[model samples]
Target: MGVVIPLEENKNKHASVKPLVDLTKPGMERVNQLILSKAGSDVQMIPEVANHLISSGGKRLRPMLTLASAALFDYQGDADVKLATSVEFMHTATLLHDDVVDESDLRRGKSTARMIWGNQASVLVGDFLLGQAFRMMVDVGSLEALDVLSTAATVIAEGEVLQLSVAKNMETTEDDYLQVIRAKTAALFAAAAEVGPIVAKADKAGRNALKSYGMNLGLAFQLVDDALDYGGKSADLGKNTGDDFREGKITLPVILSYRRGTPAERAFWREAIEGGKSDDAQLEKAMGLITKYSGLSDTIARAVHYGEMARDALAPLPESDWKAALMEVIDFCIERAN
Candidate 1:
């Protein structure tokens, strides 16, 4: 319960993605319609599983980034809608597959699809979503966009594999953790933002700017998620506290705590994390070690670093409400860890 990080202390005002939501609402409606239509399958259970997760509360931030980036340039085409939906499908597919891999029972504070229908069903439905995502990418008819997203999809899978390879591995370093997230999370965000400029026919510099913005924003978003897991309200977490510990996943905080702790403390972490003994008591002990070592605060500090990078990424782009909204997204991410 130690939250010593002043993540947004320098900011005088709260940052809200409300402006982004308002800006993208109209486009999001189209994206939502397409999501439902495309999520459908005559197989009945397919839509059931897909819609169950889709309708569950997710910010749809990736898709909105696509829409907002495109709108920033005033692109007048329906292709961005398709691209946005494709971005969402990619994200949804990853979640379904991740739950199966993590053996997670709850997501967004509800029963995971795998929990209800079983793992085999969840994996197949995830594959279904992936197929649909590529189909939409093709329909969008932009090879550049297709290339960007497809490469991201490949990288995401690679990131997941890397994470799996490192599970319960206390030796996992900060750089190793970041590499996994860069591929698993940031790649899609980068692609989602980059393609908007590609489709809008904006210059390469603008595309690069959005891509950089997105990649950094995604990193900031996930680092905060890592911090929140150890020191955030359950409502913000969307899953039970200590799920990461229970799952034995190595995160930055754990890395810092283990590296900085006393020898006996290290032994405790190795037993709980490396030896799979993460009961409630162990969880409390682990959190204590993380706090004593400044793990939570340092993790938030890392998130703040990336949040600054995300903000600076947009500096070269011309100013607009879309740009302002995107900036708010960076702060909103860090402030959540406050």
Candidate 2:
């Protein structure tokens, strides 16, 4: 299973998510209740499928961001809870849909919902979660928050499609891959962080700050995952190591390795990735190529760059346990994985 973020690698014991978890715990309790309530359905299989993934080992960091973002402004209301629940449902829905699309067998070290329930069921449950997410948003009665999340929903779909467009294509550039991640992974993070300030009626600058912070954090988080796919073990990712290669995902490491490779190495990538023939030996070779070309290290460097951007984005926000906790998140995302 993927080691949870804030793993044992944290040398900066001070740099932990404990503060964020503690700060959001009270609010998160309510978010959990909303998640359980909304995930229910008269049809038994719906709840079963939903619960399978929902109870999996995810940290629910996105919704925590919503709670902490609101806490940053000291807003005392329940709307943020509903919004947080919405964010989680959106996240869960995407995971279900993603497993189906990627044909992934494992998630969080458990059998994927698609693996157990079948793709049709996973897709249907994901759609149901999206519907429930919109309902929760409507309950919050914030049009701007609604717009942000709704746009995220649309953008995430676009990102999935964009990823599919570029999948296994060695020609995919860094920009194309970055755009896909911005939409698929970062869009919800941006939405989850922005909605807190919106519901709290914070200043425009604060909302923008959180949004930018989340966007950069999301980028950093995914880049680390990209590097981990090649550089780390299965325990680090929860899924099998080199699943990206098996799935033919043209992530940053692949892009970098492809671009920096010799003509023969490039042909190997074409045969292994674009042609979809990667096996254990080829995966090892690919890892070596990524290392030989500094793809893994450079990917981590990009993650660090974005991590810095995420911290800088929060610099103007009022200092509080909330802000400091959020700052720690930037490092935890990098250090825990690296």
Candidate 3:
């Protein structure tokens, strides 16, 4: 079982009540229905898996951005809802494949698709979702939107492969890590926000503004996610702490910790991370070294820096509730413990 913690003790306690766009609002409801319809009837078991994943619940941050961006432009049509669902399908597909690729057993506090259904089934179902997303795109009839989503999917796939290759590759630099993040996580976020303007038929400048907003937000979000694995609880984060290191994935905290440690400390990390499998004593020693070297503080600082960048990206947007909400979301990206 995963570690359990009280929700009331979460780091961002106040954020739990933060305002969000009512996803059940009439237009948003239409979007949810259309998303299910567009997902299509796959082989019986496959569609069931997709549905299970969808219903498992996430913050739906990407689709929420799409809806907020569309509302900002006063989009009257309900096509925005369908488009939002399309973005979600694409996001979900990536998650399914990501679990398989990483050999992950847990996601959102539940057994991962790969753990429950086997790797082959999980991967094949992921492909089915990707195809369904494209069909939804075709229905939208926006060639520009189709192009953007397709390119994002390709980049995300490449990014996943690159991260896998760099696993336990001690020479991996911060720049290399950021590049992987941009491709794997930010590209889709950029596309998610960019689609809103296209659907609303906003002009070039307006569309670019939304794209920038999503890009920076995604960067901040992923950095914090990486940092939390080392410093957070399973009940709060929906996954086990140290799973990244246990799986031989060297993330920002580990990288910085090794870089700042003594030569002997660094060598120990190389054995623990690169050579794989750290005994309890070694893991405890590594955690102490990381704390002494201040790598955890550095990682958190980096997340805050990017969070500021995400907020600044929204300066181009006018003053509105949605704009303020977007800023709050950026803060939540870094401040959230879960």
Candidate 4:
């Protein structure tokens, strides 16, 4: 049987994200306005699809990081708002493209753009968002910030291709999975945090510190997400619990479980994952095997390791409310698994 934890304990664990959300509210309001303004277009379908995803409820964590990191140095300019909006646009564009690439039906607990508008419109709108993001970046007139975010865009694309190459390959290693998440998820996070100090004219050390914190925090966040796919509720995930299994996506839990299972168990995984027999019964069997091999617990342990690295990244920065809030974000990302 899967090890069960108390429901109230899990609820308490996820409460850490709330404070960061509350703290970033004022700056996030400006970011939201810019997001809405930029999402509008002369073409009806363009705004239709873009607004659909934008209106969907996400925590806006990336832009919040941009805002909070700027606040850490007490930046006086309004460029942070524009830059934060750009960061959010980049994120939204990625989600639109990812849903199409994954052929997913749902995202953020709503039907995906592709599901409602078709793949052509979804891809085109995603491209439009990327263009808008770059326009805003150029308006900021910071070549360094532009360079960092643009480079991240390239890395994210490469990461998507890498994940495609490894999809459903049972031999995929833990190292390989780490590279994919670093590029696809953590690269944007590093760039988002790094740009804040650049815009604020903070020293190189401060810039690197936030970047390190974001990178490690992102790794931890995705690791917890991997564990939650097996152990969490759909309400918490904003998608079906077994979506990863149905997609035959190789995640950390699957990697650990596959590596540790017996010959017969490995054979079952091959049939279920590689062979794409991921129906409800197969999903149940997969969960049982994952529980038996302690996959969920091991993945959470990995997340905790990265979370500690994130906390250590902030050790050198002078203490401030922004720094404290960012630290809490690390806790929130890991505790979501509880």
Q: Clash totals for all models, in order? A: 0, 3, 0, 0
| Tens-digit per-residue lDDT, 1-338, candidate 1 | 84655634536257788999999999999999999999998999999999999999999999999999998888999999999999999999999999999999889989999999999999999999999999999999999999999999999999999999999998899999999999999999999999999999998888989999999999988988988889987787888889999999999999999999888998998999889999999999998888888999888888888888988889887889899999999888888776
lDDT of 3 by residue, 1-338 (tens): 11122343223445421454553266566767876776557368787778767877677888888888777677777667777888898899999998887889888898998887888888888888888888878888889888988999999989999998898887888888888999999999999888888888888887888888888888877877777777777776778877787788878878888888789888888899899867667766767776777666676677667766766677877898767777777767766634
- Arrange candidates by lDDT, descending: 1, 2, 4, 3
Ten contiguous residues with the weakest lDDT in model 2: 1-10
**lDDT by residue (tens digit), candidate 4, 144-255:** 9999999999999999999999999999999999999999999998888889999999999999998998899889889988888888888888888999999999999999
Clash count, predicted structure 1: 0
Candidate 3: residue pairs that collide: none
Q: What TM-score does prediction 2 earn?
A: 0.96
Off by over 4 Å in 4: 1-15
Give the TM-score (vs. native) of candidate 1.
0.98
TM-scores, in order shown? Answer: 0.98, 0.96, 0.91, 0.96
Superposition error at 108 for model 4 (Å): 1.1
* Model 2 lDDT tens row, 5-100: 332333355467788998889999999998999999999999999999999979999999999998888889899999999999999999999999
lDDT of 3 at 93: 90
Model 3's lDDT to the true fold? 0.78
